[model samples]
Target: MSTQFLDMRISSDSVQDTPQRELTSSSLFPYTFGDIGLQTASVSPSNVNSVRVTLNAYVRLLMAPSSNPTIIPNATFTVRRNGTTIFTTVYQKPANQLDITYEMAAITVVDFPPENEVLLGQIQYTISVSTNYGIGLGARSFSGIAVAGGI
Candidate 1:
């Protein structure tokens, strides 16, 4: 049995097991805070496969807690294969998505590929983040996933 990411669902259905090994800060693409900022969290086949791509954009608004805040995080997700972008999702800040006075609702996962019924059971997917206007993922960028055939 091959590994998959039990968390990344293609719809209200699939999950993956190859989580921990799939994505990592070093394996991802290092896009600046303005360009196509993205990083490869994890991918199937332990390499770039043409099967499929799934991405989740995680954002944490870091306000200095002072009267003046300058650094704003750009929350978004995208994927690329061999240097070509196959998917991209932009998460905009809510109307008051900046005010650090109160706690607000966080953004959710933005799925793509139209969610077709006849999907590819086994596909190689990669992840990346938008850094054009926000800070990138640092130390806490590690996750877990079980591989197929018991490793």
Candidate 2:
């Protein structure tokens, strides 16, 4: 089997000292923190068969009794491709934990079967976080690569 690289795209952002933004919501609503747009090369369905996407994020989870004694801090992270969800993760900390930093990473591969027609065009990937109490995002990175191979 042989494979060829078709296209690649990456987006990254970070804050120096403080978090980029402190997200807090009484309702469960996702806040988009990072996004990237990738233009895939037009190729024959027989030549391209898969796309790989990777995402990384640095976040601070804070749970303070003084701030919100009634509720425990929890956050849900989601990854979407063109508004469609592909992956999701959740982080929760006890009130006693106070503050913690986490480095999260996720990867996914989209494959097109031989019988199905391949769709290649503008693609967008986004990372979002939803919280109940409070959460902070320090950095985030998203990347994707399209490859051609026999499927």
Candidate 3:
């Protein structure tokens, strides 16, 4: 079966030398770093059955030492759709490391069957980050895209 592309949407925040945002909570909470909104055309489930989402970001994580030197530093990146979690990625600093930075990408495909396909209208995508042992985020560029397609 040939696939049909129904819609596509993109959003981004590109800021050079952006100020660092401190994250102190070890728990995984909604700390929004980026967001995007996509409006999908109303279609029958037989016509479109899935949405492909891609997220990219440049992140800098600076680990601050805690009172106990042995505690490891870690950070988590999460992707949510309409207030529901769709994907999550975790970064753990190597033992004795003080800081790290990198560009990360996450992708996921959401499937809908004909009987229960309910994803329609306006959709919201959110990106959140959290760290343990205190960490700073700086000079970042975050982007996301949503593509609705069917086979």
Candidate 4:
């Protein structure tokens, strides 16, 4: 994608730091409830290339201690722009450790709105996480931040 990311910001101290959010296993689907966050800024649609979009997030997921820590958890992260899906990925949380942290990063590209109009308004950035298995219905935490800047 030719779209660029501008003004990246991390929710944690820095892009290198991984933030963790707790995840409780779901009885309904084995996956924990979605942990969602949002970041926004205004932009000038006329300057699509120059238009700044905040992105580049680093996520760290910590699995709760359990008797069976080897089950492994399936994790999914999604990023959306203007209510449109721009990026998505799935991975398995690492297993076996006193305190295990699974880290992942995402870099997003700006998608021009339909009809290429000069949009002078607020823009939306979204981050969400979904996980299943790990520790078998056990509680865990996933931490991450949006690293803002232009690609």
lDDT tens digits, residues 1-151, model 4?
3442333333332233234334445634323222333322333343343443335544444554445655566666666655566777776654555565544444344444332322433445455556664432222233323322244
Q: What is the C-alpha lDDT of each candidate?
A: 0.33, 0.59, 0.59, 0.44
- The C-alpha RMSD of each candidate to the native structure, in angstroms, is 12.3, 3.8, 3.7, 7.4
What TM-score does prediction 1 earn?
0.32
Each candidate structure's TM-score, on Cα atoms with residue i matched to residue i, is 0.32, 0.70, 0.70, 0.48
Per-residue lDDT of model 1, residues 33-75, tens digit only: 1122222234344423322223433333332122224534334
Candidate 3 scores a C-alpha RMSD against the true structure in Å of 3.7
Better of 1 and 4 by TM-score: 4
State the weakest 10-residue window (summed lDDT) of model 4: 135-144
RMSD of 4: 7.4
Tens digits of per-residue lDDT for model 3, 1-151: 3354444554444354456677786556646777766555554455455655455656566666555667776778887777777778787766765445433334343423222323555567677778776777765555555455543
TM-score, predicted candidate 4 vs. hidden true structure: 0.48
For all candidates, the clash counts are 26, 0, 0, 22
lDDT of 4 at 18: 32
Whole-structure CA lDDT of model 4? 0.44
Poorly placed runs, candidate 1 (over 4 Å): 1-73, 101-126, 136-151
Ten residues in sequence with the least summed lDDT for candidate 3: 109-118
Candidate 2 Cα outliers beyond 4 Å, as residue runs: 27-29, 58-70, 99-118
